[model samples]
Target: MKLPNPFRKREYQILTPATKVDDSILERPEFLPEEEVKRSGKKTAAKQKKGKQLEGLISYLRKPRAEEGYTVLIAACIAILFTVFAFFGMIQAAGEPSLTVSAAVMSAMLVSAYGIYLAVRALRDKEKDQLYTWVGLSLSSLVMVTWVIALLLGLTT
Candidate 1:
């Protein structure tokens, strides 16, 4: 004899789609007519135009004034001067008998890498201020100065 059925299954009746349902009965009585829909479309267009005008006014009010060019020029000058000094120092060091060429080269490389990183970051951040740009440019110029000095000293010997 088979052991009493260990598992009992529940029986469910299959459902068929309702043939008596009327789809029209589900619609609301306040349905918009075609003309009303067109009128609503026109209203939306007018609203969008008004929105754009408001945005234009807001932007004009919030826009920043032009920056002073002199500030940028000064920053650039400072960057250039520093770069020149750094380069001269590197060159003088290289020319000295006790200085190691490897250290000079490494310092130059580090300055160059750091300059590039700063420049890229400033650009990505949309930094319109000339200060960051000047700093980055100065750092990059310093790298060039160091490299040139090392080369000059190496060749002079």
Candidate 2:
């Protein structure tokens, strides 16, 4: 029995090269020319030591990627911790100078400053994403400004 086909055939064409290609273009040579190999021999001890010395710094700088960098993320987290400390100090205030609260506020300030530093560093890195960096910087700046205003008001009274 003859049946009607529901789908039509899709037309396509296959292509072939007119001439043979060079094998060298397709494969890597076992040995390169002297001029092509800039550093043919093993690295000297001094160069190896220098590389080892800079390894830590290089890795730290390399953490910045196409996505948000780790330093900026860490800065944001630190700023959040500063906010927590600030709120805790405010809530636990005894209306008098408390050593623990004073310490907390100071520590929070220092940590937030460090967070701002990290954010600035991350922002300076051209390879890193700046969204988190800006967030961290703004939050830290806001908290610092508020703290300064509060301190001023306290001194005025």
Candidate 3:
């Protein structure tokens, strides 16, 4: 009879001894110690610097024909505002076409039309960024569509 040795490796299996690890490698580094800590606002300074950089970039992007952009922005604001007001007015009136509701809707349509015109003008400017211009145009177009639908419904009823 053959006796098997406990430390002998089997033919179909392989094993390796574990290697020693350094304490430095095993331990995680700690945060800044209390003695080394200071009252410097480094994080705030970095955030402010980043904010200034973003502001500068935005100003640079908006450098061309700024007035047209402003107009488009104003018109878009007015259109959207009046459109919402008119919608609420209509709802309050219970679908009744009151003069105030009609006026609000008309104003919304006019402002949206103006916004579209300003957007088109901005688009024609060779150096304009056109980001706000496109946004204004889309918003105005949406208001205009909404007004038209309201008008059509009013006419039908």
Best by lDDT: 3
TM-score of predicted structure 3: 0.56
Where does candidate 1 stray beyond 4 Å? Answer: 1-96, 99-105, 145-157
| 10 residues in a row with least lDDT, candidate 2 | 21-30
Model 1, span 51-79: residue lDDT tens: 99888664433433214323333444544
lDDT, residue 66, model 3: 47
Candidate with more favorable, higher lDDT: 1 or 2:
2
Model 1 RMSD vs true structure: 14.2
lDDT string for model 2 (101-133, tens) is 677667667766776777766676785557667
After superposing candidate 3, which stretches have Cα over 4 Å from the reference? 1-65
- The TM-score-based order of candidates, best leading, equals 3, 2, 1
lDDT of 2 at 138: 80
- Every model: Cα RMSD to truth: 14.2, 12.8, 13.4
- How many backbone clashes are present in model 1? 0
Model 2 reaches what TM-score against the true structure? 0.49
Query: In order, what lDDT does every prediction score?
Result: 0.53, 0.63, 0.75
User: lDDT ranking from best to worst?
Assistant: 3, 2, 1
Worst ten-residue run, lDDT, model 1?
Answer: 63-72
